[model samples]
Target: MNKALFLGLALSLLPIGCRTSNPSTTTSTGRITTGQRNQQAQPFAKGADIGWLPQMEASGYVFYNDQGVRQDCFQILKDHGINTIRLRTWVNPSSDSISGHCSKDETVAMAVRARKWGMRVMIDFHYSDSWADPGKQKKPAAWEGHDFPKLLTDVYEYTFEVMTALKAKGVTPEWVQVGNETPGGMIYPEGSTANWAQLAQLINKGYDAIKAVSPQSKVILHLDQGNNRERFRTWFDNARSHGAHYDVIGLSYYPYWLPGNPDYQLSIDDLARNMNELVERYGKEVMVVEVGGEDTKPQNTYDMLVAVQRRVKAVPNNKGLGVIYWEPEGARSWSKYPLSAWGNDGKPTKALDAFLAE
Candidate 1:
């Protein structure tokens, strides 16, 4: 799911002797060394992507509803050197209307809009009626009582429906996620167990759907709290044990949320270390699919993202694909108590200059 999730990655960064399917080789200094490196670190920004879709807009701004801002915003982002648009699809959002949450049609429209303006598109599937995140994983209304087999069938149908439509429209997705932040597992209890065989079936259903419809698209199995090396090791070990298939391993990194002492803040050094460990441990390609920081002056949160990126790029086995700000531009929370808070600009918040600067 787009809202539900979350990198250290490179394939070939491991030892030439002992081989894993997706190995990440490392140097003595701990900086990532790999033939599959995306780009070398430099002051200039390269190989990164940006976007502001309604579901995953780094800001979650409501300007999208206005139609005017929505149109202009797309152009504005493109004008600023942005080359991609990412949209999230919530399976059968409660209202069925594009205005209420996100839908397949709305995402296609957004993709059409972006394509018309020359930007590539990546569609995310949350497989739920509402948001899918580490904290809450809601099942879609249509798949209420479905068993694992039925659920997998629904996954294929729904995914095929969306991708098939996109292909016919000449706006096929450049990338598609099988499920959102599937840390606890996707489609709920059935495939939600720590069991890999069951979970792998769900993931494969999604992967198969994409390949059947959009063969060119890359599929991802995104996870959250990427900084925790052990958790990632455990998750991927389980996923592989279960036979899950995916092209990229997307991760969510929020330094503020990382566990530690009373402070628990992440320094640039910490970011580099954790991300580098990812490549050495998982070998799967990694992308910081979802990221965010608060909007205080000095761009406190934005600084963290910049630092994190810089550090990741500096890692010994760095592949440093890129990072995406998860709704950093969001307006306010969408819940009663207000939980839709990845990005908000109500207060005089700092702009995203920091992330852009470096």
Candidate 2:
């Protein structure tokens, strides 16, 4: 959902074997080579939120390479310099079948695929059967009547189960988001920002669950209105005061919606400024975890991405991890997303070239 609009109202891979054996190039004996090792050593994330790919593909959407040949959707992103994949999971969304595909099993399958492709995975737990965001964080059906304490337990148990399932499949997410976009807090009144203490406790439970199963996995506290410095400071400050622990701060930015939104109106440059300030203030790695632009103006989108990349990389001490294009695959058959980076041909538009930016 486009939160800025609502708030204003009221509110890869490799080459063939022609190769020579260079000593610096460690042999790939079922182990990562030296170059691959160095790439992993770099402390930055170039990612994409591809949670829609599986469903879209299942619905007959096809992705193609630049040459117009059929290609694996994930391969396309990997070819374009994306090193991380972000998938969102819901808690028993099956009651509403349309939303259920991103259930625990489905998300694990996607994560396994990503790991097989040598990409880092980020699990975004929406904590709801359907969409959960700053505007609405409806509790899952099973937890609707639970009090704050039980809700906390629910979060922990669900997180642990998901993590355990992923581990059993050899898919350990490098990062886990406790909630989708919780600017107003999650699970409605009981865990809303109005009750910061309970909200913090709930988040901590999810955090603890993640650590229990995968200590190396980083926990992210995500909120929308990426350009709104005041909102971020207020939310994070409240969370920290209530003892909420997290490893990364994730933000969502969309230029098309931010220009005139009363709640968060900031240009690209303004976003960069806010990001730098956020990194300096929090001393935590920051990621523009969600970003998109108008699909009609592919070139403009490309330029905007370049600008974002430069700004993020400019963060002092490289604390700015990366920028993720949210659902750039929602083009052509999935015209619902006007910000998709795919063209009518079912191939990525030129805008995706921005990922190649240095």
Candidate 3:
């Protein structure tokens, strides 16, 4: 079966509170503080995509520290050594409980909070009102029925608008993904990989828009299945042939969600191999922008995370940027996501301790 089909099946089975009164050190011009500006040069990016956070908080899902004391969610994550926050933006998302409400406004607010917490930020553009992944890339409802040319304009304008909004709030993302897990492509038929030329055009529009607003931000083109070398080679080769512009290759690694739920040991080597090959082949930096293991198995998850980090760090000359857990704090009790690194007691699992390693 194709990767997209497997992803569809996998999904069919699947399902910060700390008030900081500290005035943000960010300049009124919306630029990061000098100290944060310097930290942007760090070689690795340890991150978590808390796109579901606002909703979780509004739903009254409280977070606690390892001591079991109620704490702000951001504090809990920072305590576990998380240094970056990834937020997903939807053009005009609804207020749905599980799969909605990451609108640009919400995203900007989240980015501001992340920066205030002294964490680097990554913005992921789903370009849809809801989830866009390997199996689906539905366009925002407003963009429906548009012609190819109009679609290109939509991509560029939407991207620019979001980037501009984030900038207005003094949150310059350190990294931006044009699309989320777009192995087949994004925005459906017009932007689908079925036509590499069109797909490249759509991707370039988002890329150009990002550079226009945040020239220093490293733009990432993301896809799922980090361990599948053939998938990367084929898709990226087509992208290169069609002149898709991007600064980095982003991948998602989820051993637990693979077709057969393989152990991380079985695929960690392949992920490393693919990352090294990507750097060698395209001369582009690579990052595991998304990763997770079974939250119930803390020790095993911890070991897998350490090994994954070791492999990424092993890449010569730091071409291997780093790994980002998808949503380590999205506790299963609240989100029904089995892959998070948080426990039922509202504390981070030992799995997140891997980041503290080395």
Better structure of 1 and 2 per lDDT: 2
By descending TM-score, how would the candidates be arranged?
Answer: 3, 2, 1
lDDT order, best first, reads 3, 2, 1
Worst 10 residues of 2 by lDDT: 12-21
Model 3 TM-score on a 0 to 1 scale: 0.89
In TM-score terms, candidate 1 sits at 0.73
lDDT of 2 by residue, 1-358 (tens): 4532332232001111000000112121112234433432354677888876776766677789888999999899889888888888888776332344588988899899999898989999989887787667889999988977888899999999999999999887888899988999988888899999999888889988987888767688998877788889999889868888887799888767654532222476777777888777766667888988777788888988888888888987656778888878767345345677899888888888899875
Predictions in order: lDDT: 0.58, 0.76, 0.80
Candidate 3 RMSD to the correct structure: 6.2
- The worst-scoring run of ten residues by lDDT in candidate 3 lies at 15-24
Clashing pairs in 3: 16-73, 17-73, 18-72, 30-170
lDDT of 1 by residue, 200-240 (tens): 88788888888777665667778877766666778877876
Candidate 2 segments exceeding 4 Å error: 1-43, 95-98, 259-266
Ranking 1 against 2 by TM-score, winner:
2
